[model samples]
Target: MTHEDVWRAIERFATEHGMSCSGLAKCSGLDPTTFNKSKRWSKEGQPRWPSTNSISKILSSTGASIQDFTKFIEPHGTERQ
Candidate 1:
């Protein structure tokens, strides 16, 4: 998925889970700014890719499986055949 798409998914997921970006980061054992919009943008104006470990932690904290997160990352109708 595109970086913007990924971020949007993450943001939506966080909201659905009743967690703010900082709350998600705390739940994931990351710095409060880990999921911050500012951190999502790099100095070069590129999107900072999230690490697998962080994603795993986020999933764990949200009590969500990888498959669920995958759906967020690539929602049903948005997927290509």
Candidate 2:
């Protein structure tokens, strides 16, 4: 998936759970700014992806499977894992 796709999924996942990105991050034991749009990029404008640890914490806290998270990833690219 693309960086945009993953971030979009995280946004959709948060909305699906009735939480903002900040709320999701906090609930998952991360800093509240972890998922902020600002945090999704670096000062040099490179894409900053969410960490696997961050994803794991969110899934664990929300009782969501990796499959569940994957569904939010748009199939707009040819990349596969």
Candidate 3:
């Protein structure tokens, strides 16, 4: 998936769970800013993808499968870098 697609998936996953990105991160035991919009990009304009550890934590904490998260990548146009 494209960088934007991946971010969008995370955003959708959060919304599906009735949480904001920051709230999801917090619930997953990560720093609240871990999924903030500002953290999705670097100062040089490159995309900053989410970490696998964070994804695993979120899935584990929320009882969502990888397939469930990947479904959100399907051209929904949510978040972006």
Number of the top candidate by TM-score? 2
Mind giving the per-residue lDDT tens digits that candidate 2 earns over 1-81? 689999989988998899999999999999999999998999999999999999999999899999999889985664344
- Model 1 bad stretches (over 4 Å): 74-81
RMSD of 2: 4.0
RMSD of each: 3.7, 4.0, 3.5
Candidate 2 lDDT (Cα, whole model)?
A: 0.91
Per-residue C-alpha lDDT of model 1 across residues 1-81, encoded as one tens digit per residue: 678677777776787788887898898889988888888888999879878888889999889988777666764357434
Against the correct fold, how does model 1 do in TM-score? 0.82
Winner on lDDT (1 vs 3): 3
lDDT of each: 0.80, 0.91, 0.89
Clashes of each: 0, 0, 0
Clashes (candidate 1) = 0
Residue-level lDDT tens digits of model 3 in 1-81: 788888878888999999999999999999999998899999999999999999999999899999988878865445334
Name the 10 consecutive residues with the lowest summed lDDT in model 1.
Answer: 72-81
- Which residue pairs of candidate 2 clash? none
lDDT of 2 at 23: 97
Model 2 — which ten-residue stretch has the worst lDDT? 72-81
Model 2 bad stretches (over 4 Å): 76-81
